[model samples]
Target chain A: MRIRSTLTFVVAAVAALGIVTPAAHADSTPTVRELLDKCDNGTDSCVFHPSSRTEFGGARHQVGRNANNCSTVNQNESIAWSDTTGGSNSIGITITAEYKFGEEFSVAVSATYEHTWTWSHTVTRTDTLTTPPWSVGQIFHAPQMQRVTGTYELHFGKKFYGHYYWYVNNFSATGPEDTDDAVTFFTRAMTGDERNRCPKSVSTAKEFVSTESTPAQPALVASVRPGD
Target chain B: MRRTVATLIALVAGLAICTPATASAAPATHCTLRLETGVVTCGARLAAVTNNDVIIGRVFDDQNYGGSSFTITGSHPCKNGNGRDFGVQLAKYGWANRISSLQAWGNCWLNLYSGPNYNGDHDGEFKADTPYVGPLMDKRTQSIGFD
Candidate 1:
């Protein structure tokens, strides 16, 4: 009886001193989604930095419609993404064009394209409008462009059996769902006069991801043209 | 009478010791990141978690990301001989020859080798998440590349 009591006392003492450590098993690892929720609940193991606004001008790639004093003109524009890494990337940019001639000359393109290397999905928009026979040298204007917005997650790993931490990398911006408008040009029939004529405008917008966790990601850029 | 007393004592001591061990059998780390502020928090977490900065790839010691893990991160994606050349030498990081599954993100594809420095038996071009890297390649990864 005395020996048993001594052993029990020794065990309790060791337990109190915290000399015993439990074995760790990795069979029930937590999913990434679960961890994200923990962060949302304001756990300190995760470091979060709010995203800042990044506004960029979409370079305008213009398609010119020459005036035919004889009649109205019909125009059609088609766009698509021919190459990409697929839909893991959900962000897109919208393009539009407005003519300085009048608000009636305003063209809003709801067609949004993903930021990818090759363009595909032939989206064609057609419009027909009358032009004043005497009107020449008409210029179309491009209004303000849209901004990119979103958040990114950075998971940092340590050399432990089953341990990791993460940071919230955010990007915030407020702008129209659609971006830059297109402009049409008119030329008067005159000899040695190029003033009424505007060369084609090709605008390219490059999207970048800014995070304190990594270098600027320029690979997310896409180039668009009026007819291409 | 003596045997019964001894057995009772052993049972009581055994329960006292085994209780905490059972309670902490699984020491999984749980973490999360806030969308608005970009802050992260963790629960039932580890004492330390080092940031690798930019994440390009991740390796798991078990299938379906259910074990110890090592994250592969760099300034840029894995490139050929030049460019960013983001490659991880597992042995150098104390994870040599110990990988069973993996994933690639940040515009990257993965290439695995059984030996370090792009040597040994090779497999992959894994552009998608792979739950299992095959028996021949399981836990045989000595080097990794992010392309």
Candidate 2:
């Protein structure tokens, strides 16, 4: 007589079956935080530290602007623009959305780039900050975004799951350098669920997932994890 | 006959005190599986899993992660081919491993590298406890090297 069988397997998600009350919408367009760590209801809800933010303000919905110089000298020094003596810097970028029941998605950052001397008598100029408009690479210029954050869900014998990342900073004048350009984008999660109904829409593949390379670079970005 | 030899020794000591004693029923633990890179031989799906050595599978990593391979199997601690070749050299360049609270299937993760960027993630389960619903995430990456 050996009849012992127990199965309490609950890998439930779909946003945990209902409840995605993101009411407020006076219209700003850019509040997408479809997480998936362990809470699925239908469109893929199980992304724990899911996040979203598109601030750098652009002075009000412009989402575009630039100026940079994290100037720290001696990467082997060279700074010679006619004996230096000019300064100017400013920074502020915001588009916050807190809700995983509240918030801790920290990022109120500021910026500063210095070297403002628009000159007038004859002509004197300088502009050393290459091209990059507050990039995560301009988030692919908004291809409907299923990214720009991290973590996603859905896997096992059918396919799909994921882990994307960010800690982008450029267009800098100050405040956005935990250090070195940050990048990572592992993936799979995108199965079902939709915050309540039509929260944009993007179901990660339900699968038999396997990984090993594809721009999945991340050790510590966004908040810092290298040497400090 | 001495009361029938004491009733045949009290019926042989009550049939040896109603014999019944045995123990040893625990053995079925294997892991280090790889999917997308290939392999899902759970035929009848292991009869719909309660625990058939835990081999749930899936594969599709290729948006810069191309085709790779992996394996680790049973009581995994280490040296099962050196922990399955160090999880195939951390999925051969990208890396992945974030399995949590999985007494059964509430949280799960494993990807060597699929594309763009990766690592540090957990809680996106599958295989029978199925909750994701239907499919959608396959944008096309393919990064084994040489862009």
- Judged by DockQ, which candidate is best? 2
Q: TM-scores for all candidates? A: 0.29, 0.18
Model 1 C-alpha lDDT per residue in residues A39-128, reported as the tens digit of each score: 324332222211112334434333334333321122122222111111111223221222111111111111112221111122123333
- DockQ for all candidate structures vs. native: 0.01, 0.03
lDDT of 1 by residue, B48-141 (tens): 2233334456666666543445554443323332322355555534467767776554345688999877689989876545667888789898
The weakest ten consecutive residues by lDDT in model 1 chain B span B1-10
Give a tens-digit lDDT track for model 2, residues A177-225: 2212222122121122211121222111112122433312232112121
Interface RMSD of 1: 23.6
